[model samples]
Target: MGTPVLFIHGLWLHASSWEPWVTRFQDEGYDAQAVGWPGDHDTVEESRRDPEAIADHGIDDVVEHVAGVIRGLPELPILVGHSFGGMIAQRLLGQDCARAAIAIDAAQIKGVLPLPLSALRATLPVFKNPANKHRAVSLTAEQFRFAFGNAVSEEESDQLFERWTIPAPGRPLFEAAAANFNPHSPAKVNTANQARGPLLLIASGKDHTVPETVTRATLKQYRHSEAVTDLETFPDRGHSLTIDSGWAEVADTCLKWLRGQSL
Candidate 1:
C-alpha cells in the first residue's frame, strides 16, 4: 500500500476543511484522510449549528483522539497538521506514530517562548473571556478577517469565513497558554526524540495567530534533538495558508520535502 498521509485541521475548521488537500495528496499516491477532534461534527454546518457538542475538550483529549486514529492506520502515516493540529502532530511524532510530519502555522507547544503581539491579538477572542475556557468559542467575521484573512482580500476573507469557519473549543487554548508555567501541562511535546521521524514547520509571514518568530522558537527547541527538523516560510500568507488561493504553493513545498525523505 502507498504511504498514508493524515491531515489534521486546526480550530474553527472541521475535518472537511482538508478535503481538497486529501484529493491533492491522493493524486500523488498518498492515502490521505482528514481526522477530526473527538466530538467534532462531521461537517462545518453541523458544527456551527450545535457548537456546544465540542465544548470543554482540552488539548489532551485531542491528542489522545488523534493517537487513536493513528493506531488504526495500516502503516505509520505522514502526519500533516495545521494550527492546533500542528501541535497535535508534534505530540504524535514524540510517540513515534508517523513516518514524517508537517506542522503549518502551528500553535506553540511547551517551552516555546517569544509570544508576538499579533499572536496575542489573534487569540484574544478566547482569552478575553475566562469563561470561554469551559465553552465553545466562535470567531466573529471581523476577528477571522484580522487573524486568518489579513493577507487576503476582504472578499476572500468573507468567503473563507463563511465557508470554513466554525466553533472551536477554548479549553485547548487555555491549556497551551499555561503550558510554560505548568510543570505537567498537557501541551508538552518530546522534542528530543531522534526516532520521532522528520518534521517540517511551515510559517506564514502574515499570520497573526502564529508568527514566524513563534515557529522559529519552536524550531530552536527541536534543534536539541537528533531528529531532522526543518522550517520554511511562505511570504505574504496568513493563518489561512492551507486554504487560501496560494495553498498549492505550500502544498507543493511540503510535497518536495516529503519526496526528499523517500516516504
Candidate 2:
C-alpha cells in the first residue's frame, strides 16, 4: 500500500459519506479508509435502524477509537477529518501519531472562545433538551438545510440530507458547549506540541455549524506551538462543502495542499 490516509467523518453523516473522497485519494495512489465512530453501523440503513450504538459517545470516545485504529495500521497515517472528526484528528495529531492532518470545518476545540450564533442555532436541536446529553439526536431535513446545505439549493440540500444523514450522540456537543469552563475538558487539544505533524485547517464562510470565525479562533489556539499549522477558507461554501455537489473542488484543494508536504 502507498502512504496510509485515514478519513474521519463528522456527526450526522455516516462514515460512508467519505466514500467519494476515499476513492479520489486512492486514485491518486494513497491508501485511504474512513473509520466510523464507536457504534457506527456499516451502512446508513443499518445505522438508522439502531441509533443507540451511535449515541452517547463524546469527543474523548471518538479520539480514542481512532487512536486505537491507528495503532493497528502499518504506519502512522495522514488524518483527513470533517466537522467533529476534524477535531478528533487534531487531538490525535497532538499525540505525535499522525504524519499530518487536515481538519475541514472542524468543531470548536477548547480555548476557542468565539461562539457564533449560527453554531448555537445549528446545535439547538440537541441543546434544547438537557437530557439529550445522553441521547442520539437526528437533524430534520430543514435543520440540515440550515446547518449544512444553505450554500447550496433546496433540491440538493434535501437530497443530501436524505442520502447521508444519521443520528449523532449529543454528548460531544454538550461537552464542547462547556469546554471553556471545564478544566479537564475532552474538547482540549495539545496545541503546544512542537513535535506534532503538520496541520491544515479548512473553514467554510457560509457554514452555520462551524463558522469561519470558529476555525480562526481554533488557529489562534495553536500560536504557542512551533509546529506547522495553516488555515484555508472557502468564502462561498457551507458546512456541506465536504459532501455537496462540489465535493471534488474541496477534495482537490486538500490534495493540492498535501502535494507540498514531505509525505
Candidate 3:
C-alpha cells in the first residue's frame, strides 16, 4: 500500500481546505488525513462568531498538536502543509516525525532571507493593531480577495471567501514576524538536520504571502540536505492554491512527487 498522508492547513483555514486534495490522494491509493489547527472550529461561520477560541494558539502549541496526531498514526505519514501549516510541518520534520514533507507557500523559518513586499502587505493588518496580537480577526470579502484570492475570478473568489476564510489567530503571525530577532522563539524550525527525510518546497508564482524569491531563499538553508532538497514552482497561483479553481493540478503534482520518494 502507498504511504499515509497527513495534511496540515494554514492560519484562518480548517482542515476542510484539504478535502479535494485528500480525495485526489486517496484515488491514487494513499490513505489521507487532514488535521485542524488547535481550537479550529468545525465551520467558518461558527469560528467567526467565536474567534477567541483560536486567538491564543501559538506556534509551539500547534507543533505539539500536530505531533500528537502523528504519534497516533501507524507509520510516519507523508506530511503536506501550506503557509503556517508548512512551518509546523518543518518543525515536525526537524523532530524526526515524518517520512517526507512538502511545504507549499510556506512561511519563513529562521535564517530565511528576502522578505517580499507582498508578504508585508498581507501582514500589515495584523500589525496595525496591538490588540490583534491576542485576538482573532476575520477578513472582509474585499480583504480576503486582495490577500488570498487575487489570482482567481470574482465569482470563485467570493465563493472561496464564503467557504474558507475565518478569524485566524494573530499570535502566530506576530510571532512569525518577530521570529528572526527572538533567540528563544519556537517559530524557528531546524532545517539543518540531514536526516529529516526528503523536503520539497513548492512556491506559487502569484502567491503574495510567500513569493518565489522568499521560498527559493529559504531552501538555501538546508545545505545539509543538498541531494534530497527539491523545489517546484506553479505559475498563476495565489496563496489559496489548494482551494482555488485549479487545485486538482496542484494536488496531482504533489501526489506524483510524493510517489517518487522513498517513503
Candidate 4:
C-alpha cells in the first residue's frame, strides 16, 4: 500500500484549498486527503456566505477533531499543516499520532518565545476585541494583504484575498495567546515526547503571521526531543505560501524531504 498523507488547513481556509496539493501527492503515489477544521464550511463560497457556521470553536476542539480522523486511518499518515493547522499537526505529533509531520508557517504553540511584532499586528483584529473570544473574525482586504500577501504584488494580494479569505474562529487565537500563562492551556504540545516522530518546521521568510524567529524558537524547543526536528526557510514567501502560485515549490520540497526520510 502507498504511504498516507493527511493535509490540514489553517484558519480561513477550507479543505478544498488543498485540492491541488492532494492531486499532486496522489500522482506521486501517496494516498492523500485534506481534512477541514471542525465545523468548517464545505466550500469557500459557503464559508464566505455564512462565516458564523464556524464560530465559537477553539484550539482543543480542532486538535481532537483532527486526531480522531488520523486515528481512524489505516496507517500513521505523514501530516502536513498550515498556520493553525500546523499547530494542530504538532499537537497530534506530540501524542504520537503520525509517522512524520510538516508544519508550514505554523501558528505559535506554547514555549515558542518572544512573539514578533508582525504576528501581533497580523492578529490584532481578533485579539483586540474581547468579544472575539467567542466569535469568528474576518479580515479586511488590506489586513489580509498585510498578513498573508506581503510578499506578493498589490493586485495579486487583492485577488488572493477575494478568492481565499474567510472568517475564522477567534477562540483559538485567544487560547494560544494565553497558553504560556495557563499551565493547563489547551495550546500546549508535548514536544519532549520521543515517540512523536519526525517533524519539519517550514518558515516563510516574509510571513508576517509566523515569522522566522517564531519558527526558530519552536525548532529550539523541539531540539531536546529524541525525534528529529528540523527547520527550513523559504525566502520571499509569505504566510500564503501553500496557496500562492508557487505552492508547487512548497509541495515539492515536502515530497523531497519525505523521500529522504524514507517515509
lDDT of each: 0.91, 0.94, 0.85, 0.89
Instruction: Please give the lDDT score for candidate 2.
Output: 0.94
Flag the better candidate by lDDT, 1 or 4: 1
Give the top-scoring candidate (lDDT).
2
- Tens-place lDDT per residue, model 3, 1-263, is 56789999998677888999888888888889799888888776777788778887888999999989888888998899999988888889888899888999998887786888888888777878988989887777877777788899878988998888888888898888888899888777777787778888999899888888878888888876644778989988898898998888888888788768845
Candidate 4 Cα outliers beyond 4 Å, as residue runs: none
What is the per-residue lDDT of model 1 for residues 1-263, given as tens digits with 9 covering 90 to 100?
Answer: 67989999999888887888898999999999999987788888888898888989998899889888888989898999999999999998988988899999999999998889998898999999999999999999999998899999989999989999889999999999999999999889999897789999999888999998999999998877988898899878999989878888889899999998887
Better of 2 and 4 by TM-score: 2
Residue by residue across 52-78, what tens digits does model 2's lDDT show? Answer: 988899998999899999999999999
- lDDT (C-alpha) at residue 239 in model 3: 87
Residue 126 lDDT in model 2?
95
Error of 4 at 258 (Å): 0.2
- Residue 198 in candidate 1 has what lDDT? 95
Error of 1 at 248 (Å): 0.8
Candidates by TM-score, descending order = 2, 1, 4, 3
**Runs in model 1 lying further than 4 Å from the true structure:** none
